[model samples]
Each structure stands twice: as C-alpha cells, then as structure tokens.
Target: MATITSAAPAATSDDRFFMRMAIVIAFTIVAGFALNFAMGRSTIAARPLVHVHGLVFMGWVILFLTQVRLATGGSLAQHRRLGRIAAGWVCVLVVMGLAITVDVTMRGGTPFFFLPQHFLIANPMTMLCFVALTTAAIRMRRRSDWHKRLNLCATISIIGPGVGRLLPLPLMVPYSFDIVIFVSLLFPAAGMIHDWRQSGQVHRAWVWGALAIFLIVPTSQIIARSPVGDMIYAAVTQGHPGEKVPGLEFPPSPMPE
Candidate 1:
C-alpha cells in the first residue's frame, strides 16, 4: 500500500510534466511557422514538394500531441497503437526532411545565413539524431520512464528549424546555426531540470539525448568545412546554380526593397 501510494503520485507528476512539455514544443513549432508565413518568409507559391513537406511535418506535430494526450489520460492501449504508427511516421518524416534539404540546396534556396554545405549536413544530421533517439524509445517502450523521456528528447532534437524561424537569423549571421542549436537545447535542458527536481537525479536518457544535440552542431560544422563536405556538396549541386554558390561560404544578404 505504501509503495503503491508513493508510486502513484510520482507517475502522475511525470505524466503532467511530459504533457506540458509536449504542449510547449507543439506551440513552438506552430508559432514559428505561422510567424514565418505572417512575415512572408513562407509562401503559398512554394513548389508542390515544399507544400507536401509542410503538411507532413505538421501532421507529425499533431500526432505527437495526440500521443501525449493518450498516454497521460491513461489510454495506454491506444497509445501503443499510435506508437506503432508513429514509428512508421518517423521514417516518412526523415525522408521528407532530407528531401527538402536537398531540394532547397539544389535550387540555391538554402537560408542566406547558413553556408550551403552546413545546411546540407546539419539538417540530415539532426534527422539522424531524432531517428536514433526515437528508435531507442520504441525499443525500450516497456520501461515507461526511459520511453517517455527519450520520445521528448527526440522531438526536441528536430525543433531547431522551427526555433531558427523564431529568431532574427539575418541579424545573427555567422552564428545563427549555433544560436538556434543553443535555443533548441533549452527544451531538453528543461527536461533534465524537471527530472532532477522530481527525483533528485537527472535521468541518463536526458544526458545522452542532450549530448547528441550538442555534438551534432560542431561535428556537422567540421564536416561542412572539410574536403569530404566539398565533394558531397559538389556532387549534389553539379551543373546547378548552387555550384556557383560557394558551399563553405555564407550567401550574401539580399538587398532590402
């Protein structure tokens, strides 16, 4: 009876914490994109592929919020069913993410603040991080503590694009990628703090997840500046407008109207 009583509250507290975190993340993504659209940074005139990518990403956010609700609401049976679907969704998400990265870079549409090489490398690396963490979450689903925390981290990993949109990337210039990464880490950092406060120790899953995000930024930059990065960028942009755009150099700021 004592164990049951104590465990009940801890579990309830965790559910509430995760639920809140999910809502915040969802809001961040939606607000970032909506703000971009409002500012004319995004457009309805974008190619069909871009539109499909947007829809796919928005679908994942909705699905993520739904999963959190089901789990916190004690609908584990339904949550697991959705979990199976989410596993497949991650694959589609990754494909679309990589596809859009290549599509934009080929069109010379890579963000002005990012080196084309860095944008190409970083986006895919971020997706890979999400895939690895999410795979771990699914495999350890029976360990609810590890499972939920890993899922949160996985979602947090990919929010850099959304976070980037919320910031003044033009003003950020050389350090925009680094600043976006630092802001994104705040989500998982909050998770770590919450875990510490609740249990007197931070969970190892949070540590690993945060570390993955931390390492990927520098690692991607290093590769983007290396010979291998040159070869990959050259191959991808062969005979295209992007080839004339220096892979390692940031594109010039557009002239104000």
Candidate 2:
C-alpha cells in the first residue's frame, strides 16, 4: 500500500510533464506559421492544395493536444478511441505533406534557402520518420511511458516546417535544413534529460527515437547530393518551372525587406 501510494505521485508528475511538452511543441508549430503570416511569408490566398495542407497539418496539432489532455485527464478510453482517428489523420498528413512539397517544387515555389531536390527528398523522409515513430508508439500503447515518449518524439518530427519558418533560413543558406532539424531535437533532448533526472536514467525510447529523427540530417544530404537523387530530381522537375531552377543549388534570395 505504501509503495502504491508513493508511485502514484511520480506517475502523476510524469503525466503533467508530458502534457506540458505537448503544449510547447504545438505552440512552436502554431507560432512558426503565425510568424510567417505576420511577415507576409504565407497566406490563406495560397492555392487550394496549400489551404488543405494547412488545415490538415493544424488538425494534427489540435488532435495531439487533445490526446495529451485526454490522457492526462485520466480519460484513457477516450484517448484510445481518439488515437484511432489520429492514426488515419497522420496518413492524411503524410499524403498532403508530400503532395504539397511536389506541388510547390514543380511550381518553383521551393524556398530560396533550400535546394529543390533536397527539399523534395527531405520532406518525404521526415514524414516517413514521423510515421515510423508514431506507429511504434501506438504498438507500445500498453506501455504508457514508452508510448508517451515515442509519440512526443514523433510529433517533434513534423515541427521542422514550423521551426524553419521561425529561423532566418535564407541567411543560413546551405545548412538551413540541417540546422532546423538539429534545433528540433532540443524538445526530445529535454525529455531525455528530464527522464534522467527523475528516474536516474534516460529511457531507451528517447535514444532510438532521437536517433531516427537526427539521422535525417546526414541521410538527406547524402541522398540529395547523390546521382540517384539527381535522377529523381530531374524526373520530378522535367519540363516544369522547377527545371529552370537548379536542383543542387539554392535559388537566388529575395530582395532585402
């Protein structure tokens, strides 16, 4: 009885910590996009596809916050039921994310700081990583600690878009994508540190999940600079406006504001 009583407080504390982390991540995403809109970098006037993409992406953030609240509020059955809806939602996110990347690239809308080829390849790779981590978290749902950490990491995976918007990416040039990816890791890194302080060791899920997210940096560079990547890029941009823009080189920066 004493052991149960002692452990309950710790579990409650952990739940609060994770709930806080989820809010921070969701805010980072919302703030990033909001920053872009404030600077005239994004708009509702974008194409229909872009509007759909934004709505779907925002939907995931909302659903994640809902799940975190549901779980923390001790509504596990509600959490699990909503988790099923989230599963389908992520699939839509992946598809919309990739489709928009392709659409933007073909239209020569790839950000000036990013090589079109790298942008094309990296977005899909990141989406795949998100799916992989999320799937693992769902599978480990019975293991609450593993489930929460993995899901948190998975959500972190998609924040690159948000983080990039917040950074002076044009100034970063060749390293912009990698830098955004690295900064995004801080969220999971914080979780690892918190776990170590509270439990005397970091969880294995954080190590593996962070590794998966971090690898996108070098893996994206290697593939984007490779012959196979060139072929894929050429095939994608052939006869399109993107063809006029070099896949391996950054586009000319917009004039100073």
Candidate 3:
C-alpha cells in the first residue's frame, strides 16, 4: 500500500511535468510558424518545395504533441502505436528537409536575409542533430531518463528557424542566428534545472543534448566561412544564388518590425 501510494504521486508528477513541456514545445512551434507564414515574413511560401517542407515539419510538431499527450494521459498503448508510425514519419521528415536544403542551395532561393553558405551548413546540421538525438531517444526508450530528454532535445533542435523568425535576427546582424540559437536553449535549460532539483544532478541526456547545441554554433560559424566552405558553396551555387547575392550582404535587408 505504501509503495503504491508513493508511486502514484511520482507518476502523477511526471505526467504533469512532461505534459507542460509538451505544451511549451507545441505552442512555440505553432505560434512561431503561424506568425511567420501568415505574415508572409518567411520566404518559405515563395517556393513549392519549401512549402512542402513546411507542411512536413508542421506534421512532426503535431505528431510530437500527440505522442506526449498520449503518454502523459497513460495511453501507453496508443503512444507506442504512434511511436512506430513516427519512426517512418521521421524518416520522411529528414529526407524532405535534406531535399529542400539541396533545392535551396542549387536554386539560390535562400532568404535574402541569410548567406547562402551559412544556410547550406547550418540548416542541414540542425536536421542531422535532430536525427541523431531522436534516434538515440528511440533506442533508449526503456530508459526514461534518456528517452524524454533526448526526444525533447531532438524536437527543439529544429526550432531554430522558427525562433530565428520570432526574434529580431536582423537587428543582431553578424550574431543574428547565434542569438536565436542561444534563446532556444531556455527550453532545455528548464529541463536541466528540473532534473537537478529532482535528482540532485543533471541527467546524462541533458548534458549530451546541451553539449551538442553548444558545439553547433561555433563549429558551423567556423566552417561556413573557411576556404573549404567557400569551395563547397561555389560548387553548390554554381551559376546559382551565390553568384547573384554576395552570400554575406544584407542587400535585401530585413523588414521593419
């Protein structure tokens, strides 16, 4: 009886915490894209491929929220079913994302706000990070310590674009993307703090996830501007967008707030 009663509270608390986190992720994604797309601020609407990419990503957001809701509601059976489906769905998402990245690089349709080279490196990296983390999360599903945090990190990984739109990326100029990436850390930071307060130490999943995000910024920044980067950019944009746009200039300038 004692064990059952104590376990009940712990289970309830876990559900509450996870449910609230899911809400945060869902709201952030939906609201960010709604503002960007509805306002015609994001250049994604201009191209058919980009439009499809948007739909696929939005589907992931909805699926993620649904899975979280199902698990928290104690519908583990339904959640596992959805998890199987998501395995296939996530593959589609990653493929669509990479395809769009290639399309943008070749066509030079990158938002005038971003340097084509930076877009080439950074965009794909985000997808790769998300894929790796999510794969680990799925594999370690039996270990809730790793499962939840890794999944959250993976989902949050790709939100940089949406976040970039929400913030005044232009106002920051050279450090624009970096600022948005940093701000996005708050979500994971909350998780880390929760883990600390609850367990007296941060979980390995949070540490790994946070380390990946922390490393991404500096690593991409360096490579995006190097000679090798220049060579890749030249090849990808041969007679393409880079030729037309200076790759680093804000000539098309961000719009007024």
* TM-score of every candidate relative to the true structure: 0.97, 0.97, 0.90
Question: Each candidate: what lDDT?
Answer: 0.90, 0.92, 0.80
Residues 152-238 of candidate 3 have per-residue lDDT tens digits of 888888888777767767678767777777887888898888877666788788888877776778877788888877887787777
Candidate 2 pairs with clashing backbones: none
Displacement of residue 23 (Cα, Å) in model 3 is 1.3
Score candidate 1 by TM-score against the native: 0.97
lDDT of 1 by residue, 78-195 (tens): 9999888898999999999999999888888788889999999989989989999999988989998888888888999888878888999888889999899889899989998988
Off by over 4 Å in 3: 1-4, 42-45, 248-251, 254-257
Ranked by lDDT, the better of candidates 1 and 3 is 1
